[model samples]
Target: MDDSTLVASSKSGIEDRLSITAEFYTLNNVHANSAKYVLLFSSDPSSVIFFGLSPPPLINNNTLTLTSLALTTSFRFLGVWFSLSASSQFVLKQARSMVKDMAALLTLKKLLAQHVAYLYNAVLLSRLEFRLQTSLFFDSIVQSIIFPMFSIIKRKAGLASTTPLALLYLKIPFSIQHAFCRFLLGKKFLLILIFGNLPIMLFLIFKNLWVLRVVLLPST
Candidate 1:
């Protein structure tokens, strides 16, 4: 079955809720029998879910419980990393490594300036597009990753590091990095969600934001 996450407000009823959920999904022929779940506490560790075995029906849970569930400080949900520690260095390090690896291909001698630019813009840079939508990238983080891609483009185009950055986008074949891709994409998504008028978005918008018509303006 596809991945799913269950959220509980407090320690109370966590066991019963999990058992009820597991049994319900298991009876429905979903892969809910595996007692595999990680706890990430945002505030007090004791304030969240209960620390105990799932149930006998969940086979894998028997060995997992010792009056407590496994607690982790960080875990990746889908492609984005979520952390209770509030440090993004791990995320940034991985992103930088990925960019560096992809940019290394730019050093190939066979690729023309346009070809280099095309590969960088189309393939390598597009990798970040999906991730940008999920996380808030600060300006420093943006620059840290963006500069490497630009540097590779500069090297491939026989330009020095000190060369005018504007020239790369204007004169050179390389396109400027869409550092605002995340914000632009988010705007587009919100526009669609707002104006598309799907039932769910409509319900949420009207329910929570009916009094706040200012959001209907250009770009709230």
Candidate 2:
């Protein structure tokens, strides 16, 4: 619980609970003076309303205190940016421009086709795959991201902009990439690990059974 999030319907509720938690931690010889929180009220702008004055400074038993949470329209957590406005055209616009630039520079060296293909996958596709798995993305966004990889292919092959999509990739020396399938397979591997571990499987069975019992219990 060193790094955690606190969510509440009002500013006072979060501050009150956090103070209590801080007290308990002080008794256990663990003190937290550094914590950051974002206040999100709505995905729609009109619904976002200020509830009260700024939260009081959070101080631990050591008398160390953190500054008040500042107003923010977006926040980055674990390398992903979430916008309060519910719109971000993905951060990889620059990643695409970067790959395109790298390809352009690599062309000057006249690298062999196989070498270019290797770099494209090892460097470019690998990053795209990592970003793909970070969160669930809309289909339209995925399609836009997918569309550029082929343009890179055509630029390298000296093909026309109107070159068929299949031919652009399938006919290339690298063969059509299965990155999306690979992303799906990565998720499937986690399921395999969860099922294979005996302790985890048993814990999951008991947890699920308890939940079902609670859910199916008659109302008072």
Candidate 3:
């Protein structure tokens, strides 16, 4: 044969062998069963029939009760409002009983001691309740009381704003203090109420009035 004819015959033989392998792979379900290649025999295709092995029996659904509570790995704060309410009610009742029993003792010193402790607890409980209910009112009272006290302290420490008086009446801080001192030391003590504190008092009053007007105007 010529060189071209010989090459063509060799290619045809290789193609025929590949075609046979492909046909076998497509037609057969060849699976390795074990590490050592154990042959498994089966008849039913819908259900798996294990050969040379006894299958475990299925448990009956009705006989198996699933009362297993799903345990949550979490912290739950409030399970129910009844639990919290009942707890607070119990504490309140206990405190009331303690207070009543102490009152019944009737000795002055013991009564005072009991009253002091009760008052402290009552104040704390009232504060807690106030925070829970009427929060705005409680906050307003706190702000009103604290801000004025702070302002007074700031004023006494040579730090109070003299700008209002200065803007309204052209008086410096030293002059304001001097004026207060003179009012305390002279016949123009009426001017103490008139000048020293009058402006601050009037300013607060006017501020409150303006706020009230604004609040009421919306309603009206």
Which candidate number maximizes TM-score?
1
Lowest-lDDT window of 10 residues in candidate 1?
A: 208-217
Q: Score candidate 2 by TM-score against the native.
A: 0.45
Question: How many residue pairs clash in all the candidates, one count each?
Answer: 0, 0, 0
Lowest-sum lDDT 10-residue window in model 2: 208-217
Clashing pairs in 3: none
Please give, for residues 1-220, the per-residue lDDT of candidate 1 as tens digits: 4455555444434444556555655566455323445444443432333345366564344222312222334456555674444456666666688788877756655766677667766776667665554455676667678677777767777888899767877643566656555446655765675567675854544331100000111221
TM-score of each: 0.59, 0.45, 0.15
Worst 10 residues of 3 by lDDT: 208-217
lDDT score for candidate 3 against the true structure? 0.27
Every candidate's lDDT:
0.54, 0.49, 0.27
Where does candidate 1 stray beyond 4 Å?
1-4, 12-14, 20-37, 46-72, 134-140, 180-220
Between prediction 1 and prediction 2, the one with superior TM-score is: 1
lDDT of 2 by residue, 1-220 (tens): 3354555545455545556555655466554434333334332232323323233343333222333322234445445554433444444454456556776667566655556666766776677666544344554555456565555556667779897766735645656555555556656654565568765765554331100000111223
Q: How close is candidate 3 to the true structure, as a TM-score?
A: 0.15
Badly placed stretches (over 4 Å) of model 2 are: 1-72, 83-88, 91-109, 137-140, 187-220
